[model samples]
Target: MPSLNPASRERVLVLLRHARAESWGETDHDRHLADEGRADAGAAGRWLAEQGLVPDHALVSSATRTQETWQSLAEAAGWSLEPQLDDGLYSAGPDTVLDLVRGTSSEARTLVVIGHNPTVAYLAQMLDDGDGDPTAAADMVMGYPTCALTVLTFDGDWSALDLASATVTAFHVGRA
Candidate 1:
């Protein structure tokens, strides 16, 4: 993990959509990551490491695919932190997920959240302050596919986070 100055007020939030999964499963939450998904997730982890975006904490969906994605990504990134697996994230909408993010501990300078589809995409769009990397923002607007991740930077505490509070610094769709 990257060392953060204790007095720094800036925070980084990484939003990641779970990697691709097999189409058929006993239940939606039971599906595990496809072989390709595992490779792609590793690519995403490598990218995060290259960018020095290691997380101090992580929030992951309890769904099998999301759990698998986090495992693969963490392995590639050499992340040792044990993620908090939240059942709420499995079914959460953007607003609900935002509330969960707001509840994050202030001590965490960098936080990552791994979850599912539309919610992750919508949350990435919703959090943008519209004043960061234009190309990255454009790519995010174009589409958020499986293994897609967005990096955002914001000031102040997590409790104060709200719509348009953060600036999107980077975006990537990992593939391998």
Candidate 2:
């Protein structure tokens, strides 16, 4: 994890929904990303880099598509951190995912979570404090399609994060 100034109280949380996946796999958890998904993931990464929102740490679902999305995105973004893959994330709800976020280390100022929707989408909406960029929030309301991501800023520790505790700063749907 990239070390941050301990005195800084603000933290960035990125919620990402995994890109499109092939439908013919034996199981959903084992399904891999489609060609379009790979391209979209790369696009998402480049966009994030341009925004200077590189994450210090990442939490990803153990499902193959989510793992592949993270790998492609990280490679395109030139990020060199190892992501934590949690099997529970494959089926976790918004509250379960929020609990996982709360367990994040304080050393990480920017964290990313890659998982499935509507969990990811719901979490992003749940965190909004109604004080962020109105345009971004409006865009998010349209729907969280494949490779969609939301950037939120919060004050205090990750453990203190809750509904309406964070402000949605940006929202985008990466496509290629």
CA lDDT, every prediction?
0.92, 0.91
Cα lDDT tens digits for candidate 1, 65-175: 999999999999989889999999999999999999999999898999999989999999999999988898999999999999989888899999999998888899999
Q: Summarize candidate 2's per-residue lDDT along 1-116 as a digit string, tens digits.
A: 22222236889998999999998798979999999999999999998888887788899999999999999999989999899999999999999999999999987889999999
lDDT of 1 at 40: 98
lDDT of model number 2: 0.91
TM-score winner among the candidates? 1
Q: Give the TM-score of candidate 1.
A: 0.96
Enumerate residue pairs that collide in model 1: none
Q: TM-scores of all models?
A: 0.96, 0.95
Give me the displacement of residue 11 in model 1, in angstroms: 0.5
Per candidate, the number of residue pairs that clash is: 0, 0
